[model samples]
Target: MTFEFTADDQLYQLAIVLVAGIIGGELVSRVHLPKVTGWICTGILLRGLEPYHASFSGLTTSAVSSFAPYMSFVLGYIAFTVGAALHFASLRNSGKRLGFLLVGEALVTPIVVMAVMYFIGGWLKPDEMTLRTSLILAAIGIAAAPGTTVLVVQETRARGILTRTLVAAVALIDMVAVGVFVFATAYLTGLGDASADWHEHWQHALVSVAIEFGAAFLVGTAAALIALGLTRTIVGPAFLGPTMVAVILGAWGAAVGFGYSGILACTFAGIMVSNIRHDTVRATGAYLHSIGGVLFAAFYTFAGMKLDFSLVLEAAALVGLYFLSRFVGKYVGAFAAMSLADVPTRVRNTLGLALLPHGGVAVGLILLVQENVHLQDIADTVTTVGLAALAINQLLGPSGTRFALTQAGEKGKDLPRLLDFLDEQHISVDVTGKNKEEVVRCLAAQLYATASRPSLPQEEFIQRVFEREQAASTCLSQGLMVPHAILDEGEAMTGILGISSEGLDLPTPDGRPVHAVLLLATPDTDRKRHLEVLAAFARTITRDLNLREQLYHARSAAHAYDVLHAEESEEFNYFIEDALTRAGAFSENKT
Candidate 1:
């Protein structure tokens, strides 16, 4: 039977796409590959079957192409969300380590890829070998897939220095890649014209690109302010999602109309809102993340539908070369850079492996290259090589990232239970203190006395705790306070729990007097773990009213420890199991 498509049929087409994408994501997730790989494979399968089955045609090329505008919207949204990682506080905390790594990887990746590609091209296809072609390919190689990296990090809930650095690096890499591509494109355009004034053309192209970037920045900044303003008046996902969508789409449209970068514009807007209105950005991000899985499935499926197997097969050699070169470049460059920058050994070893995924931005760059008049002669070859490399990398990159995280000891590890660090000797049910400083001093003395090897004198430790409290009140709302510090000579994390029956005058966000105080001290190296422990305490005590009451009203230290341990056991198990499943270990065991 012949299939007659109509505008109304688009809904049915969308349903099929969603279902197929979901199935594909689920299938691959079970087998230990990234869900994105499966989504793309589903699209490829549907497209390949189209010739044999006429009905399949509707769900493949034509149907997917119809959703291009929607796909672009999703891409812009993903880019914007990724930009949230560029928060100033995070950068300030990370400091020079992150900056050095970003510069090193960004420079090394393009240089290595270009050199390898140039040599390979000269040997295999001398006609296609040109400095301009090599530079364009290198520029494309500079883009690491932030979307994939972010998704995988979220999936595993990986937290550590390496993970933080990876996120920051990915964000910086894209910006660098855009800048490189702009300059490289201008240079290529000048090269294409031998008789024309090269310097004049270069100057003109650079000015035009700069104008496009400026327009994008202005549009993005305006959209961010508007979105922040809307958050004050609008509440809930029902209003919030659509409102933000309108803002993002408007920015995207403006970028397109002005011949600017929509991805850059959306990303800048995301960064602005995230830093300026953190709560609003977080709420919106949570909503986006909830719906993003389906959108991503659709996007990758569409990407797969466009895959030309014939082109992949013909360009197999070039694709293999490009893939290996890029892989080696990222690994060596990241490792060397981190080492030279005095990053921890564990981080330097595993970070490069996690930086392997390449999608979205790279594909976007290739499309940009394809549309340029000066680059049309090499567009087909470039696209073919890119698709093949992407296909391999998308399938393999996430697994490599998972392995790196697992090896770094960040994956499959939950925050330590309160009882894990607190023992009978470390708990004080009756604490006599008149103020916050006195309570903190009591806890610090208890912690220092209990430490296996007290790194600092008791008075010195108390002074440090007071200094930390002055910097920021650890007292959270709902009668809880976590006084924490890191000492230079400290080797292991130590905790002492103190409860005041009458409560102390501790400043808290909710202005509630603090009854329970957990003092944490760790070595300077375990900052990530220190934060995790603090978060675990806050998350557990704040949510469970009964548990908090039990601890607060406990007559003895033993009773309080029991209550805390019981609550921690349940929460820790759930997170640990989820982390294992995400790392693919649980599935492997079942198999």
Candidate 2:
């Protein structure tokens, strides 16, 4: 049956696209592949829906564009999170190394790509070749897909120096991309105008550059400051997510409306909030973390759909040259930079590969080219080559990132697991209580007494725990309760686990009495770590029946600890040995 695709049919198409993307991601992940590749692959399949039904011919195109608002939001969200990683204290020690590496890669990559493209075009396709095309293409080449790189890093749970440096570098490189593109466009415009004075043209170009960046910075900073004020004063829990989302969207919209970059503005806002609100960083991240998955799935699936295979064949030579030159340029530049900085061998080798993914930013730049009056002559050629290169990069980039992080021994170190802070000394037996408040007080007193050199005094710690419980019930389903507090100072996460034979009368979703209570204390700065540790505990108890039963019926503190760390529970513990070593090595090199 011939079907005419229209706006009304988009919701149905969206449902199908999301499901296909999920299934594709699941299947790919099962085979030890990047789930992102699966989503993209499914998107590519969805793009060819015409084969299934002739009426579906324009469905993917219209549906994808119709969801533009969502795509922009997700990109901004991803950029914000990536920017959050740039904590001042964390980057201070290795700032020199990062600076050297960024300058090397950012400066060298474009030069190599432009030179190669220029020479290759002259030899192979002189009629289509121009310095303007080469310059514009190289300007677009500077950005590695922050979304893809961040997704892979998060997916593998990689941490340590390489991961941090790669994330920070990607964020900075995109900014470099914006600057380089602006100047190239400005100068090219001046070059196109034969009667324009060089001195006057330079002044105008500088003004344009300053305004483009200045407006974005002002918008982002203003948005962050406003959000910070509201979040600090607003005591309601429900207000956090919406408040932050609205502020980010405002920054994005304001920047875009001013004829600048929304992504850059979002990045600036994230950096502002991250550096300024160290204590509330976790709360800020939690909102994004909660909604990130579905949004990412939708964004990536649409990314895959945008890949037109027809363009690859149409400009085979240009695509081949563009992809190869860009790859070689990034790798070589990164290696040279790392060598000069005397970084770890593993990181030096793998860092470039980690930065290979290309997406949204480059596509935006190419679109800019298409819209420019003077650059219109070669816009189609640039777009075709640029997009085809991006398509190839997306397919190969995630795997490269996973491999790079793995080789650097930085996988699975992003967050602490539950067992990392639990041991025999901290797990208590015969935890006694009559009611929920009593139970919380009992756990708090026990944990504080047992803690070795705690930052907070015994009474203060107990009071903090009580205040947390007062704010929100720590009770969970399956007769478990987790009470946590953020301290002003802490070297690491410290906590106590209590097992009660006689259940305490606590509020729970399942209306069961509390048999187990895990009290946690982390420094205010380590909020994300606090959340992840809580997640680990919930996941363990909810998934393992035998382990939970063993912990409840344990004979002593030792037995309880054993139950928590048994062979079955090993999967829940995420700390790996070499991750620490790599982190130390990274520091040693910096020193």
Candidate 3:
């Protein structure tokens, strides 16, 4: 039957997918879960409509089929963006340990999986399946999904030896597994033919995978070289961005046209663009961020549409076997590898856990294998197992990473942060007089007292600030003092004003003294952050002539800050009008 989708039907289908996908993704993200799982699960659940399956069966017809490939293209860009984030030297240090672990897992996972599958196949339907069936099933078990794993890690903002090592290890290992898969798949297709040389199988698989990667690499390399040359010819880092994205998509196209590995191509291309005698990082980062939204949206929604509940209903057995193989391969390998490398105990423990994410690499590989001729059964098995494993990984990966980080003492500890009600704030009034040192000291004391801060035991806080003032005048040309200190306080940003009716003789980074001092204080927040706040405030002060004069003529702290707020409010969005050429990105908020 011809399935013609009316505009309303198309809109309905899209709305369902998008809304369900977003809600699921947001719900998962709220609970610190991997977004990929949320998206995929949303798709699976939508496909899980036991009653509506028949109603929407025609949704998968020709018109809708086009959407899937379009989604795939977007997914390809997302994949390229991920590749672009990878630093070339990320795997440099852990090469030996990672290699040993990856090789051992790749080889052992297949063997262990084959053994289990053979037994399970015997138990389930002894006369139905053969040894080749077990091998094929086992090969799928050997593959890992690098996409969701990467997602899980990225969500945690995970850093440390273990996280970095896991990322690099999985990336390299997945690439090798593709080659392993190629040979295993070829052998399965050969199917016990006595004349079919297994060696020839390896040669063919390796050649096919390698050629795909090589052509893609060549195209990407040339594209990056061209971009670099162009960036040199034109002396701004701006155009390099658009050029880099074009290179990524162009490489993606070459990979498809030549039947090459797009991941390898894009990965190589990103590295070349970043390293090829040009500073393309900012440009590349912007390009990646710009497309992140649409790619993620499409990826999640598409994933939801592909979820087949029937396969997942049969997921119980597949999930068990897939993880069993991974456990036998990954943990055992990790423990052994770390021990061999003499890694410290705490890190070694975390490494075992950190190495468990199977993301897009595994999923994409499963799809590729699924498309392979003669090994269609194997591919089906891989996809089923992969989707199942991905579901589980998405649920567990982030939480596990969080656990490891907390255990390693790398968790962000939010300290005693006084949430200064900045929506509308005013510092207390200051009343004191001049002697330079005496007036500043009295001002500090009044602030500490009024704010209920513990008095400095030796007045060293005040003295130290004064000594810093000695290095340079804290006074600006118009008489504003920004005396800041690196105090041993908790992480917080507070504004306190010091009143000196006669003013203090304090030096500025500029070369003047004797006037108004805005004692900027921070606890544990980094110096750069404090500087950012100062710079932001500085821009405000420097922008308005009347506001600066009012601040200069300030009698009390509360009154001064009122004018400060008025000034900040008036010019808070200077960049939209003043900083740029009011383009689309800038004008999005422009008046």
Candidate 4:
């Protein structure tokens, strides 16, 4: 259906999705699986079955389905973001040892899986198909879920040679798999008579990929320029959002609406925006991760809508066989690929387990080939890939990725770079607990050579802050907080952010939940430095809501510290100063 929407519907849908996806994504994702997985599950539970899955049906599904088209648009954009960023340098810098592991697993895993698929196909339908279909199906079956892989890695907060290289290999090869499928699909559609025409489709598709990639980059560049020029009171999130909409809606309209390849266009936009050295683009990305919550939620819900339960039962054999084939194929293929490249056994086993989760591309490819007249088997294969993928990938994907990182001894890794820097400098910052304490600690740390531990416990701090601020009114209301103590000499004008997923009891100046706590305290003498830091931090925090949101959910002290230091590094003081300061302090008791 056309997405020509009314103003109220637009507003309503937007509100629903944001509430469902962003706010809900955090809570449910932790309880269930990946954030994306949780979003889709939430969507389906709310939207898929009628009579509302109970009384609160409106709360769950009603909004999800209404915005399905926009969800498609957003997924097309996000999927591109997740898929498009493959580079040789990124992979290389990530590590050679990990690269060896991924390649090794990918190689060996496929061979084993394909052999099994061939046996299964031979047993089930020998006369109906040729050996080639079995082989192709077997190979296709081996395809790993790149999106799931990506989601899992992102969720684990892991970054390293192994993670980066694995993603690169998947992105690099999936297109080749698609090319092979197009050929196989063309042959299958000829009803056992394969044609060279399949080769032609790849040429067309690739040429399109090239042109679209280029054009989309230009489009994104122009878009970023326009965004950079904007200093109008637009919240930073609002700025990147409109820009993203322009990219997805303007160019993608021609593709998805016209039944052309919007996927390539979306991928191009995300790449150009992400790769460009511009603050607005980064601002836009931060906005995207936070603001597009609803669109993502709706997109997943609609994906659930596509599942045909009646058909699923009847085609159970194809379903079971396809998934079984895929599982075997991917596990072995990924392991072999990693092994041949001389990867470590520890990494190899992790990579093998890590490789099985699948999502976005498999679904897109399935959609691309679903309508062919002579491609019944191919259609069956597509269903096997998409549905089976949804099933298996969703279940083990996030957990497996988390397991991989933990096994590698990389738990609680930080995505924000600023926190790590502050850590090395020994900047004592309180990141655990409620927001106000963090804020107090941050400011307190900045002022003195000697660091003081946070005296207030999280709950007590939350209670006190709530007495002053009120419940759910996050200190992040204006995007920054500067709480100057009534006293002048005790703590050097402290500057720190309190943070928590379980929001503080502090009443917000604004009704939104508070996540980051920025405490600003200073002596009357250091007025200049206090105001200077305040102005800089406040301007940045106010502009980027997503930053506040991300910080609010940070699980570690390092991550919370990084949130502020990234934009304003000069303001943080996280260490013990020279020896004289401590020695001189003895005068207080001696006097």
Candidate 5:
């Protein structure tokens, strides 16, 4: 028996691509590399195999080429999601320093890259070097891979000023890159036509640019409105995924039909939706996240399939130059920008490193150059150098981003264990209280008595804890309650762990009697530390049912403390050390 396949069978091709991508992603994730890198690598491997085996002939290449339209939709969706990071409310809270840093990096990166590339272009390819080509290279170099940055941020569960600033800056960088590319393309067109009237050419270029931007904005706005309306009327949660897909497709089709940027259009739509119809955006976000994984895998896999090994080899010198120049430019520009903005030392030092990923947006810009008839003379050179540099950046970018996040101390760490924050005086085995207020008050009294100087009034402290409980119950599932409040003049965090043998009548969501109650009092100025303590407690007790039971059955406070200490992780120790240092309670012996 003989089996055969035809190029027209796109479903078969898609299945093969998705399966390969899934396997590759899993493999790379195991090694701590970005899943996107793995998907791209899989595509490249499949492409490489085409020449050796007749069975593999044209499948990878043909599938990628045929899937071009769908890829555009995926790109638009990615851009839109990225745009949501630019929520105005979030931006306002980020302050003017963040804005300055973003502008500084966006402007400096391209200029630095352009200057370096201009000087090196002569040696790399003197015959092809031209002012127009150099300008194009610089414009394309402005884009950084938001997808990779987002993936790393999500994987690490990073949260802090640095993470917020990095995300916002990435959104702004791509927007600025698109604007720069448009203007550069116009200038390049005028350069190619010296005989044409300068004023007329410029006027036409300006008009064309305006039309593209206007059309894109209009398309985005329309799509957003439709999606928002659908979300309001749609009852089933399952429809949300299809609704987002439809909106992305519509925006992409309109942008393509009108000779506009699908990315810009979808991004604008996302921004509008996020800001104006926030509920709709939030509802769709979960659905999009689930579906987006497979789409991104397929999109990147196809991107890898298009990689030209021969072009990469031919343009090796130019590619290396581009990589080095862009890398230096991003770091220097981010550092200088942050310094000028007077950003925190951690942000200034790490933001540049985090922004190293460069590919998706740059690839889109280069594709524009390749498809433009007016730039045909320099298209081959641009594509070869651009793709080669992009390949290198994609391979190395995620690691750089992860390193920066880790070093900045924003990546999720094991917080100080609940027991680590308490001592013999602060732990009570028999916490007797009839209600939530009495239980919380009892814990707070224990913490106050243990303090070196109990300057804070007992009544006032109890009142604040009640205020926090009123705002939101801290009761968690698995019989745990972590109530926390800020101390007015506290120098450090004080914790009290109380285990109740008989369940308290605390109104927990699960309605299970609370077996363990951990109360924390943190310095009013240190909101981050307070959250860290609560998070640590929630993570520990909720995940381990047996541990909760062990605490409930402990004969004494010391035994309960031992149970938690035994579960201490390296991350938790680091968190405790850092917290203690901030609280002025750390000593050399603790290490």
Candidate 6:
């Protein structure tokens, strides 16, 4: 059973976990469960099999620790995307109910858990560390893994108010958890030392907390600017990919190096990028998301492998108590707050269920607590209980989230997006024209030649675009124009992308020559869909200067199509499709 953990063995175990995770995920998905559940279960199974293969089963806690850096990157990426969801425009009018719901769940979950654990923990453990453990656990209680919740949402194809709210809520609560944990741990650092002055310690803890958050915020903001500058300057994905990864990892590393919350810093960076340049966030996010499956699979599987069920047996009472108390606190707090906020009855009832998964953030917090010098005395007990409870939470959390989305009638509604209409055939590179009218006519002819001809004559399609253009210039600032029209008879939406690096002589409000012209034709019956498509295109192209630059410089129609269909741009597509569906824009499709 004794084996020297070598680098080779780590690689071997990594390969096994990845393959096993994919297989496990596939199996669980067949049985109608979240793939994350399967991945975690597979990790636990691998851990259980460790003694059977001493060298290969290096999936023990030590082996899992070796992958900590990789996991940090994955969590950072997830946090960044979650942060991007915190756009101010969306949250500004989300209403006081969302605010109250957030406060209710956030404040109530920890208070209730802390109260329950403090009193019950004293009765069960009867130790000096009981209060500290309760406080620490309660602090950790607020974090729900945005990564897991978002995966479930993505897996279920859920979109709507409930999904958006839940994702944002989980992300916000996690940041709150980080802040609370930092302060609580700081205050408790030397609290039990007889020689330490409690008053001075409290004062120092306050200063430490402020510095921790303030420095993290600065690190994140600086990271955001770096990302913006790179994307704005770096034109191609070949160089952009590595640069983005470096920026994200470097930001996380810097925060951690400074003894701050790396996750929070990444989250803040994402928020800044999302609000400042949504196109950049979406494009980068889509690229990251392309590889998210493997990263998440490895992460959750590693998480499962690190669990020691022996601790569960030893702290069965405490573990059971923590699990029940935390769940009750989350549900009651969410339901109560939503009710008070006058939220819809279904949301008020089920939103709490969606918040049940406390994955990476909670696990990270407990690990931090274990490593703290002041918290060392109770580390063993806390780890035993905390990990056990986390195992239970991770196992149930995804299912809870899936159930909530299903009940909310928001599942499987994210398909048939606006981007679905555009293909290589619909794109033309180096499109030339003497004026805006000539460009519109050429784009319309190309659209007809490549795709199905609409019931309306091709000339009329050109006329409609001209008519709409006359009403108000579709020219979005920064060399982009979206000339769209509603076709009287068309089964679905179709479009063409004309890349004119030389610039079209379109009369733009900003007076910039249009370098990219997006011609959109929507079925008259689905007029609202046209508006949504126009908005999506305008937002995406205008906000992402990198994408615009690449598209303009594209060498061929296929190249332009690739630039448009690149994975980095898919996040914005998903967001628009989901948001539009929720708004009833796509409820009544033309065909």
- Candidate 2 least-lDDT 10 residues: 53-62
Q: Could you tell me which 10 consecutive residues in candidate 5 have the lowest summed lDDT?
A: 565-574
- Candidates in order have lDDT scores of 0.75, 0.79, 0.57, 0.50, 0.75, 0.78
Per-candidate total of colliding backbone pairs: 0, 0, 13, 58, 0, 1
Query: Model 4, 17: alpha-carbon shift in Å?
Result: 7.1
Give the C-alpha miss distance for residue 12 in model 1, angstroms.
Answer: 1.8
Best by TM-score: 2
The pairs that clash in candidate 6 are 283-568
> What value of lDDT does candidate 6 attain over all alpha carbons?
0.78
Q: Tens-digit lDDT track for model 1 on 270-382?
A: 78877786655666776677788877877878777777655668877788888888988888888988776665566788988999888788888999999999899878778
Kindly list the per-residue Cα lDDT of model 6 for residues 264-294, writing each as its tens digit.
Answer: 8988888888777766665676677777888
lDDT of 4 by residue, 1-591 (tens): 677544345565555545555554687666745676665555444444446433433333334456656755765665455444542222322334445544443454445545655576557755533355454554354345555566567667765434655565565445445444555554444444345466665565456555544554455445434443453445454556566566666556655554544544455555555444233445545766774444455555455544444444654665566666666655565566555654435555676556666555556666555665655554665555346545545555657676775675444454433222223123222334344554554444443222322233434433444454443333446434445442235533433444447654545677655454555434567676655555655655676567756555654443454454443332332112322355478766588
**For model 3, where is the 10-residue window of minimal lDDT?**
416-425
Cα RMSD (angstroms) for every candidate in the order listed: 12.8, 14.9, 16.3, 16.9, 13.8, 13.8
What residue runs in model 3 are displaced by over 4 Å at the alpha carbon?
1-16, 50-65, 89-91, 120-130, 190-193, 234-236, 376-386, 394-591
In model 5, where do residues sit more than 4 Å from their true spots? 1-7, 53-58, 192-207, 233-238, 413-591
Steric clash pairs (candidate 2): none
Residue-wise C-alpha lDDT for candidate 3, range 1-591, written one tens digit per residue: 798765437666665567777788888778666576677677666655535643653344233455755554554554554455454433323456667777766776667767766777447645433465566555555545445545555555554455555655655565566666666666566654667687876676667666656676797787667767777887466666677767777777777677766666666676676544424755666766765644565566565555454554585675666566665666666777767765445556676566565555566666766687776655555577567766665446545656675564434321111212121112433435544576556656644533223335438777767887779655665456667666665634544555344444554455544445556555655676566556655665577677666666654333353354331443542322333454556678765
Report the Cα lDDT for candidate 1.
0.75
Off by over 4 Å in 1: 1-8, 192-209, 233-238, 413-591
RMSD of candidate 1 to the true fold? Answer: 12.8
Relative to the true structure, candidate 6 reaches a TM of 0.70
